[model samples]
Target chain A: MLKKLLEFLILWIIWTLLTWSLALPDILAGVVVSAIAVLLFSDLFPAEIGRLLHPRRLFWGLVYLPVFFWQVVKSNFDVAYRVFHPTMPIRPGIVKVRTSLRSEIARTFLANSITLTPGTLTVDCVDDHLYIHWINIISEDPEEETRLIVEKFEKYLRKIFD
Target chain B: MSNLVIIFLSIGLFFNFAGCLGLIRFPDIYNRLQASTKCVTLGTIFILLAVVIHFGWNSISLKAILCVVFILLTSPTAAHAIARGSHRAGFPLWEGSIMDRYREDQEGETESAN
Candidate 1:
């Protein structure tokens, strides 16, 4: 109950901040509403609430942003090149590759990372394997491509949210 | 000079630009997401930090702090949701990944149930 109250207070504080409105009455009302919300919803998903407040996981994310930023820039230019090439030297195919990670959290992070990049879309992931749709085929070397994708993103996710 | 603010903004801009570049160059979905999530988060925080400083130790600063907290809260969850949804819809991982313990467990359960 104490933890729930703390969480509620934090969230209300956050809500008040995001609104950029610091009026005392609003803050009070916000706290009240959030408290009610917690009361009504606590039994529905207690585990998720616990996970949401996981500090260790969030701390790692603080370390992750810089690395991820660098990768984004490099891919943008490459994606642009593929799109602009008039002859359309793009190869469209879905390739499947396995993952070493076990948890749904890790695997899901991997999938979203792939899709967030420009030229590739995460078409699927079954049994720890990813099905990716690629617009530009830099090479037909499936092993090399698979290695590059997961090596590029999954490694960092392990650090950030593991 | 308020150099801290300037420096922070510069770093923030650099990260945001880097994220955009990664989105362009990466070979597939996984890599691009990494770039965006990392760069944007970092860039956005720095920007928010700047806002806080600019606004001074006032209500705006308080709000800025809140923004950071909320962002710290939701961004990963959003990314996770998207990734899981994609995977469930049928995306594949790379070949070198030797073990998929999650899949193994799922299969194991189904097999035993049957």
Candidate 2:
């Protein structure tokens, strides 16, 4: 029951922010819409609502954002450099890396972060291991690969989700 | 203000162009996904950032930021799904590819299950 209310509240907040409206009709519509959404998809939502709003987790999430944005920008430049370079220096391959993040949400974020970062895309994830396609293939050792790719994101995700 | 918008727009276009070029140039599905996902996602974000700047801090700008959040969340997941699908469907890597530990792991898993 509490979960349902929390979900509805979140959806209502998103609706308010997206519409940026305080009109009576708009607010009422958001309430109705969010209630319906919560009823329909409540079971699909994550089980732990309390941890989501934890102050430490929220702080870590905020810190993660700028770090993630910087990585995205750096990777964009790297890809641009490769795409325009005459030699087209790339050694594409797939490698496996292990992650310590046990929770689904944390693993998903870790995989997405890997995909968005430099010269790497997460091809698949099974259990603790993630299969990553590397554009550059710098090292063949799995530990080295994980260190270069997963650890950077996993450290922060551990705090947020795990 | 307009100059900032133009600057962001130009940076966005450059990344988008690189993504397109990578789509054409990369030898395999996974490599192409790598290039396209990173460059294009960043490109679209920058483009939307320009929209936010152009509109300033109004509802339109907030909507643009929301779009950025959606794109950032969705694009990589979509790319991941495609890459996983292509691999499981037995799409061959490029001839110049160096390694494929994923296939090895899959084979190992099947053998152990057997």
What are the per-residue Cα lDDT tens digits for candidate 1 across A1-162? 776876687668667766666788887888888888878876643333346346776776666666655554454554445444555345544455667776666676677556545455554566666656554545556578778777777666665544
- In candidate 2, what are the lDDT values of residues A59-97, reduced to their tens digit? 999999999999999999888898889898999889988
- Which residue pairs of candidate 2 clash? none
True-vs-predicted CA distance for residue A75, candidate 1, Å: 2.4
DockQ of 1: 0.12
* Predicted complex 1: CAPRI docking category: incorrect
Per-residue error (Å), model 1, residue B3 = 16
* B73-95: candidate 1 lDDT, tens digit per residue: 46655654564465455555444
Q: Highest TM-score among the candidates is held by which one? A: 2
CAPRI tier of model 2: medium
